[model samples]
Target: MARTAVPPKKTIVKKMNYLTGFLLGFGLLLSGCNKDDDGVTKPDGPDPNAANLDVQDFMYKAMNLWYFWQGEVDILADDAFATDAEYTDFLEANPNPETFYFDVLLFSDDRFSFLSEDYKELTQNLSGISQNNGMEFGLVAFSNSDDIFGYVRYIIPNSDASTKNIERGDIFIGVDGVTLTRNNYTELLFGDNATYTLTMANITDGQISANGEEVTLTKEEGFQENPVFITKTFDVSGTKIGYLMYNGFTNEFDEQLNEAFGQLKADGATELVIDFRYNGGGSVNSSRLLSSMIYGTNTNELYIRQRWNDKIQAAFSPSDLEDYFAATTGSGTPINTLNLSRVYVLTTSSTASASELVINGLDPYINVIQVGTTTRGKNEFSLTMVDDPNRQGAPYIYTPSRENNINPDNSWAIQPLVGRNENSVGFSDYTGGFAPEIELQEDLENLGVLGELDEPLLARAIQEITGAGAKFDFTVEMPAEAFTSSKMFSPLKDNMVLDKDFYLPEIQ
Candidate 1:
């Protein structure tokens, strides 16, 4: 069971189709009763009969105990409502339950905590499963302008977009033949549509203008997304430069990632460039493995320190808080450690979570030359908690379960910010985001093929490695009349997460 950590807010996930089978099961189990506080059988026990009020009660109690900022929730001591309806009425009159219970209940300025009623969809997302059109994009506008332009960052292979010959660096100015204004872009890009017609654009006189090329693409169910998008070794003036365009920290492809590193090591690569411009983050274990491979022979060293809430801190031992690097996978598979003294990274505002972890975790032991724009500042991680009473345990439960691991009957689950992560030597102060030593934006003016030496961001990294020592600027002036979407097109929200060995058992 992998914990779904909060990704950079910019990533846009397509709305999921609920599991009809689960809904049917929920409907069938609604009549079953459970032991309430008085040990009397009641209609609400994590079942469909558990109304919104019942669910809210569960959420309140769970957050009171497990939330990282539990002490700040003054409402914890006010759970004195006699019935579910009374509790509902109290919440309605509070005027700030949503704010107090959900948003403000987290550490100040935290935006990672999220609630979901679709546990199946969330679980699938954690496992790298989702429906996607296979195009990842970034929205850019001139400073302080509402007008935005759509920039193609990358295209997933074998996706509908790729099949339509849509390539990285392609710019779109309109959707469905309508000029893309900031007002209509979100609806046009993320609308519930089976198909889309994209109008292309080109840079003319330093301005984005319509190119009159329309490409129609359709969306389909993309089951599993492999994070290893591109891996190659570039020969840069006799220096073997290894380049890996890794996008996420999914554990399913651990072996494949190891193989990529193995290839670079076997090729005797002297320099490395990790492209994380669009990576939001994923599995903490995967982060550790990647760091271990990069750190090479430095296995037992502490990679990250996870600090839970004060209550959980006192309950768990020191061993539970420390996450160290494993030279090999748990099954004793030896990882390919690059053992490089310095590693170059390409980033953007979207580079976050486990991606930042890799960069920060390796900083103490190696020279991490950050290239490209600043990274998304997310140092905290979250865990997915369900409505299982026993799992939430003691003081938090009013409806006790007779069985130990009975699954929940409803889909409600919460991915709350449970802990903050720090690297070795306690270096975790990058809230505003980590800026690049060699700052350069992606060259949308003259987009180059990805994994190529001439690509704007990658080119800068190579230049740094070769000691050419030249900095390039790719920032463009904001268009006078443009619109940008609030969020970029992220196929999935499950980026960098901490993989939990156990999951709250399935809802019955």
Candidate 2:
């Protein structure tokens, strides 16, 4: 049979009516609060700084170019009745309005907002000032480099002490008094740090929850990084399992990974469980490095293929391909070809971007298993941080590129690539997420296995790797008719096992 080539799928379309309704409602909601302290009315006008600058300058100077660019593009393409105004008209008719608008807004409002908020929080935490321009904080790093670590280190307000309120050594226990556990902390910390009243005991205190009691500590200036933590190896039956809890793909993350893997391997680790319940994304290179280490040199292809705009395609140099290939085959100890793979990844709605990349990259070569909910469908790769000429420093912008579709021959062997811009290309293997071989949830009220550790997910994964039976099983008798209609009653089936004895599949 001749196989038909699948066109890329369209991006998910959200109903704009709800958005329009919400905007109108929000306007009405704020209408009553528009008065100043003396009850005098105020007029809406661009700030002096914004008014004096060129439109290009305003657009490029904004920090969040991604959101602003989309809005500007909509104004140009959708708002046909709009006057042929200076900056607005130029953006609408441009060859790549999305990219151009992203550059402009990224320079103008987005940059200013991000810096302002960062500064505002810094001042509020340090000087207890209610009003400030909010200029003290800055982005320290953002990349998908060789290392898988992303960081946003802000300067302490009005002090150069080696350690600020939330210094390098402080362990993050909670955010806004919401206690964080292994599973959801990654999503909570990504992007801007939320307002949190943190409580901390001395690191050496070794504190555990008391009977009907909680510890309340002092408030301090703090920042949150993508959640990444290390824990002790535990025994499931007779097998030893090493756990590495990863939250996101940050720069230089591979180094941290290597150290964890090395320690676990030395400790006679036989199985590994990686938790990605709330990870969003950071670097593709970081994902590649981890995949390479797990699959080893014998594996040829890393990712199936990346889709990008024609401009991006033209920009690709020979070194880029070479570097990608080298990164996939260069690091880590080789896995025994004959061994059954046992890797458990916990996922949820927040598991997206590079998280999907890791799953698609490793599934074909290893005994990969997914636990928990479906993954967020975000297979489209975007080139963010484009430079804008109007900004003083580097004008960082995020733009939507092209679509990527993996060849069918390589789809199962390599990771599946679903198009974010097109609607027809469905991710059949795992779009919403891969269903876990075993499902479990923790009970938070009892704090038994669910306090943030997600004991149930971890325990089930450990059981599968160790070949251990369930510690407790409760069966409720049900009617046959009920069983027939329930999706949970579906018959068990066999999966097509990839033959490792055969040659590794080549990238088509």
Candidate 3:
């Protein structure tokens, strides 16, 4: 029999309806429970006045809304008869929602318990100290110009210790052996349930001494910086390839990236590798900035499209495009551009949110050859915030007040908007993630460190860029085991590979 030619398969974008179906189906699976003999619903309300009630209610409402927005009806079955546990579990699945809710719940519960046990402990300790000396015992605000100058906000006074000996304006230099810096203050003093002998010095005398102290402080929870680590680079034949290790986007991240790229470019880097192995996410704007620099001057859509619900309906209109364009292009001012037209990105299961945006956005305009593993399919975006009730003197919590879809069309393009969706112009079909143009085996041994220039993948990229059969091969041999741990790989890993064959056509 004669062999028949198979036509090239057409790319299909994911539709909004399909995503709605998946979310609904998953939610229903989560809500499922073993049926009873009676086949009747059982009462499933929590105990009256239990603190968990508020959490339960919020979870149920949020999960239902999320499901509804996604158009998942199977999971939206009449909520009137739903159990509290089921609802809570549904909300828990949302990215980091449980952390916000549970942390507050746990802290509130434990705080009251501590207060009850040690209600008069401070008073008792201060009274004893005052009786032994000729000084008043009270807590004083350690401030400069009414703003907290140091991490030690409150201090107990001792009479025998003397007001003159330890004045209100005393600067706290250290606690225990740890130097008092703004970064580690809360972690060292309060977060860890450790007793600290605070070292302080009077503003007037500048005499530093360790005061006999035994007080418990609770560390207020705060967000920490997520840094991108670049490991090492080697020559792939004649092409100098560099690897950049990055996890998430941050406000001050542009400077860090600019410096790294500047060095790489100066060192004769012809091709670059970006590793997003365990990156979660950060600002969408940061992703745009990075994408802009990599792709150079081009009109590239960073996302397929964005969706707006009734709450943020204004965001869905075309008028918002001007703002989006301005934010992306940097306020009409001429911007410095990187001439590099493409980049190789290493992705894994942990790559999500803004990371996805960067990949999806640039795949259309440049060569974003994804290596390693498939990325976490999290195309949705949300604005997050936290409110300090004490400082604001009111309840403040980061709430997702508005929802916006990144794509120009309000419907899902990765899947499809609806019905039979057409293949998007200039966009690749990346339902889960863009597949590697050249698949390469991951070497577990040289995991966290950058691979040698002679590695098969890097060699291919060099061959493509510098033409085949280059005279020099910049290959370095390193230990394989060094690549396993995330910490050990600062920015680059030894076994890291970029699928080099992936390339876009040069503009004619």
Among the numbered candidates, top lDDT falls to 1
Q: All models: lDDT? A: 0.65, 0.36, 0.37
- The candidate that achieves the highest TM-score relative to the unseen native structure: 1
Better of 2 and 3 by lDDT: 3
Indicate the residue-level lDDT of 326 in model 3.
16
Alpha carbon lDDT of residue 493, candidate 2?
Answer: 7
Off by over 4 Å in 2: 1-228, 235-237, 314-340, 380-387, 390-437, 446-454, 473-508
- Candidate 1 Cα outliers beyond 4 Å, as residue runs: 1-52, 76-100, 142-147, 392-411, 469-491, 502-508
List, residue by residue over 230-341, the lDDT tens digit for candidate 1: 8899887799999999988777888888989999899888889998877777778888988887877565778888776665566555765678887787557898988888
State each candidate's clash count.
17, 39, 33
Score every model by TM-score.
0.79, 0.47, 0.44
TM-score of 2: 0.47
Better of 1 and 3 by TM-score: 1
Between prediction 1 and prediction 3, which has the larger lDDT? 1
Model 2, range 299-326, lDDT digits (tens) per residue? Answer: 3444444332332223334233221222
